[model samples]
Target: MNILFVLLPLGLVLLAIAVIAFFWAVGNGQYDDLDSPAWRILLDDESKPPKDPKDSP
Candidate 1:
């Protein structure tokens, strides 16, 4: 029974911290481009040429 007092407050504090972090992330535009990152991984990066094995010093 005594543990409930400590556990309850700890749980509430953790929940509050999680909510604050979520709001901070959203305010910082963290979720604005969710799709682009996923699609970007599937695309090939052609800007840089592949390094040649013989070019190593």
Candidate 2:
């Protein structure tokens, strides 16, 4: 039908766009360091309690 002509080209364009995006992401180092973040989050940042005004007596 007439809709096939339009839908087929539209789908092809979308697929081409997705392929370009995937390649671009791979080339830009976006997928790098996937594991480093998990290890970095295990760090501890404990804060000391505030000194009370009466503790200095």
Candidate 3:
């Protein structure tokens, strides 16, 4: 029974911290782009090959 007093407040404090962190993340645009990153990973880069040094004038 004595442990309840400690555990209850501890649980509430942890819940409050989690709520604050979630709000902070939303305010900072953390979840603004939902789909672009996934699609970007599927896209390929337009890469160019390096030329040999002997080809230079």
- TM-scores of all predicted structures: 0.80, 0.65, 0.84
lDDT agreement with native, every candidate? 0.92, 0.90, 0.95
Q: Per-residue lDDT tens digits of candidate 2, residues 1-57? A: 999999999999999999999999999998987998888789877966659966654
Measured with C-alpha atoms, the lDDT of residue 5 in candidate 2 is: 100
Candidate 1 TM-score over all chains jointly: 0.80
Top model by TM-score, which number?
3
Model 3, span 10-41: residue lDDT tens: 99999999999999999999999999999999
User: Top lDDT: which candidate number?
Assistant: 3
Note the residue pairs that clash in candidate 3: none
Location of the lowest summed lDDT over 10 successive residues in candidate 3: 48-57
Better of 2 and 3 by TM-score: 3
The TM-score measured for candidate 2 stands at 0.65
lDDT of 2 at 33: 73
Show where candidate 1 strays beyond 4 Å.
47-57
**Which of the two, 1 or 2, has more lDDT?**
1
Instruction: Arrange candidates, best lDDT first.
Output: 3, 1, 2
